[model samples]
Target chain A: MPLTINNYADGILHGVSFEVQRGENLIILGANGVGKTTLAKVLCGLLPSDAVNIGGMIPSQTYSEERAKRINYIPAKMEVFDSYLSVAEFLSLSHFNQTISIDEALSKLNILHLKTHSCQTLSSGESQLVLTASALLHSAVYTLFDEPTANLDPTRMKMLFELLKNDTTLPSKIIITHNLDLAYRLGFDVLYLKEGRVAFHGSSEAFFDQTHLDALYGSSVQKVNNHVVVAL
Target chain B: MKKLLLLTSLLLLAAAPFFGQIDLPLDKLLQSGTMEHQVFFELRLPRVLLAFLVGGILSLGGLVFQVVFRNPMSTPFTLGVASGATLFTAIAIIAGFSTFSPLFAFLGAMLTVIVLFAIAARFQNYDPTALLLVGIALSFFYSAALMVAFYLSTLQESYEIMRFTMGSLDVVGFNNIWLLGMVSGLLLGLVYHYRKAFQALLTSYEFAFLQGIHVKKLSYTLLFGVSVAVGVAVSMTGPIGFVGLIIPHILKTLYRVSADKLLWQSFFYGGIFLVLSDLIARNLGESDLPIGVVTSFVGAPFFIYLLLQRKS
Candidate 1:
């Protein structure tokens, strides 16, 4: 069964609908304050709606391993309340796959040295990497990442891009990002939200076409050598 | 540091009963039927145990409340449970049902818990802030009701209510001790069983929910368990303040570990802190000072110091 949001409407979002079949990845792209994050929360059941369904089960209704195995959502910034909870301890909570160890996920993100660091003490970029590491260990069927590279430096950004492009870590990734260049390079199916509505939902090639880019972003965005870039 | 703290805690627990107002000589205490033996066993020993168990319950309850509410200032008392107990105990004293004050106090606390949960259920989402505000409002209401009780009471009844509100640890036997011990055990067992989920909560509610924790259900279960335990403790001790609020904070600072890892530590240190406070109250002067006063006197400054240290 597919992951589906059948015309989910809320205060911020108008009528949002989408579906992702098993093993099919998706990219959610939107400008600021367009309800991208809100949609993500609704889809993952944090906002708790009957509109979101994962493999014939509503994410909000399911519990324990049955729900955990189906979907996960990684927020932009890692928020840890306890001052002394280490990164390793945080990652262990999401280690359900058993295929990849916490150490492996940390090393993959070049964050093995941060294993013993308290999660509260990590820098924003470092914390983002730690969150990404947790998603790796989680290995859920449908993992939605919100602004995964928002705080990353260029090197870490490239490292994460490689991981996401390879499609070997998580089975079906739903990445929400404002980085059009990254979205274009990933070449996944795109669902663009404009003012809480689906403005565009099609292949990345079509979404990134020069005329389509001009219509949406005007002259502020352009393409050079098959790479999407901002005019500035 | 942890080992040293543990050793010191054990030493305090062992020595608490001996340091009270009427000192019992060791040899005299050992004899079965002497006044010293009776005082040590029937009065001192049970009082210390009572203090410890109540402290443990309050401390654990505080830890759980802070985690669930995501606010460090939160404790079982903050939710008006203690105020409810205090109000009912005052009402009992005025109504000439002073003998059944504990029962009345417990019913008041449980009734507050039921009311809080009922209001929380009406929330569209799990809004802890709204619930906290409701708790504060309930506490204000209880405080006003307590004033009315005082207005209606005789002078002697008012004094009795005042003493109960200030809190005491004057149990004469092991009956209440056994009941408190069982309550403490049940609370500890429930918290221990949900330790993993509790750790997830230490991250955030959203993170815990994403981990398949049934965040709302788990939070409610833990809150209900803690409320019942705190109700029993307040009924027995008449709402000892600061032990619940300060013990968990102190343990967290000393251990430098996540709150979940400090569950047993919070409970143990909470017990020890109260026993120590009681020791000071007993030895300070001619008449024993109130247990609540001792806790606040010691807890307020120390808590402020910890906060200042954290800032720097």
Candidate 2:
């Protein structure tokens, strides 16, 4: 397990105990304002001020400085550093002695043409890709991507999941996503959140079961052929 | 890299004394120690040097403030620290307060910052925008107090207050230069030692924490550096307005770089810009003018242009 919570007596995630295996991809599913993002923040150390309201050991005591580097997150709104430097320059400045060349990162993401582009000049789509490349620049352990599917093409979604699986070095990953459609393709396990509580910890196959699917979204579902549609 | 730039700056500064309406030859000036050279050294050189030094200090201080606050408009004035210094300076001029009140100005600047910081502490979430708003209010309050002080003062002192409020750099002799040099060296050293912390500030606290930077300590360090820079600057030049505000803003927008790159760049460019501007201020007309007027005349319009550019 890459993460373990002790004596977590918060409201929603209260006494919640879950272990994620190495190289595992977990999808957090919940509507807006539920504890999905909060959990993500806590885990990645972007926790809000009243983090104790959710209960657990506080950040200063719970995690040491070195252990903190284990999680890298892409926040909801990425910070845009306005400078003359290009995308390459920004990544180089991020805590790395020998940074990977911009081309190497871009080629890995199949976006090598974006090597010379200024980050400020990129579209949201292209900028998100630059952010992704930056995340992988150092082979960072336990990369946490918040809503990776947002602003991404279908093939890129498939590419991201494949990339997660390809790292045989056993780096745990957490993806905070609401797009259940991508669950089958990207989700290894699903943490269903309902009203700030982790309601279920199971597989995507549960989405295929009519009873469980209905129970998953807490509504009725109809199975037309192989596809299950929820009437939420 | 900085050394090379420092050398170039020195050469240009030394050459400054030789170029003017009444040019002094190199050999003749050195042998006789001409009155013009002494005038240049005493009347012009020190003022220009102090302007450069203070400009560098202010720009560095402003750069750090904007970055830590993560807002483009954040500055010592925007944060109310400038008003703190200004309040005391006004008291010195208008209320028969002692002229040897730079220490009072320093305490005032820090105290005002501490007050705003304490109030902002209630937000606890580090809502920088809200803190920025609080700072603006504090500035308005202090500025109002200054105007009231003006209302109560004698006419001569009131005019002196007004002139000083606009910022003047007309001091003479070696003692003032030495004091400025000592403070600049101290502040510059502090800034460099915390270079990495400055970089950490540019990112989110989580990122900074993950990178092992103590955000709380860094925040205090930033406040200290800013107060020193603004406090000393306002004391020396009597609230030099735009050097702190405009230099860092123009530099950051132009460089489009990280806080670390822009931090040092702002210092160098600010020093160069202020020295050149002060030289012009000293000899632009028949009589000398306050350094702040030249800066504001140029900076205010340029600032407007920047806002327009940001708009469309």
Q: DockQ for model 1?
A: 0.83
The most accurate candidate by DockQ is 1
Model 2 error, position B248 (Å): 3.0
lDDT of each: 0.91, 0.68
* Per-residue lDDT over B113-226 for candidate 1, one digit per residue giving the tens place of the 0 to 100 score: 999999999998888889899999999999999989988988899899999989999999899999999999999999999999999999998888888988888998999999
In order, the first chain's TM-score in every candidate is 0.98, 0.76
What CAPRI-style quality would you assign to candidate 2? acceptable
Local error of candidate 1 at residue B60 (angstroms) = 0.9
The runs of at least 3 residues in candidate 1 whose Cα sits more than 4 Å from the true structure, single-residue gaps closed, are none
Q: What is the TM-score of each candidate against the true structure?
A: 0.98, 0.85
Pick the lDDT winner: 1
| I-RMSD for candidate 1 | 0.8
Candidate 2's C-alpha runs over 4 A off are A6-17, A21-24, A48-65, A83-85, A93-103, A138-141, A218-232, B1-12, B18-28, B31-34, B117-123, B203-210, B252-256, B303-312
Q: Per-residue lDDT for A1-232 in model 2, tens only?
A: 2554443445555554565655666777777877676676666555533332212334443334454445566654545544444666556544342455657767777877766666567776676777777667634456667776687778886776676556443266677776565565554688777765667788877744668776655565466655445556
Q: Candidate 1, TM-score vs. the true structure? A: 0.98
Candidate 2 TM-score to native: 0.85
Worst 10 residues of 2 chain B by lDDT: B15-24
Per-residue alpha-carbon lDDT of model 2 for B100-211, expressed as tens digits?
A: 5666677778788789768866775546668778888988999899889888888887877777777777768767788878877787778788886676566556656555
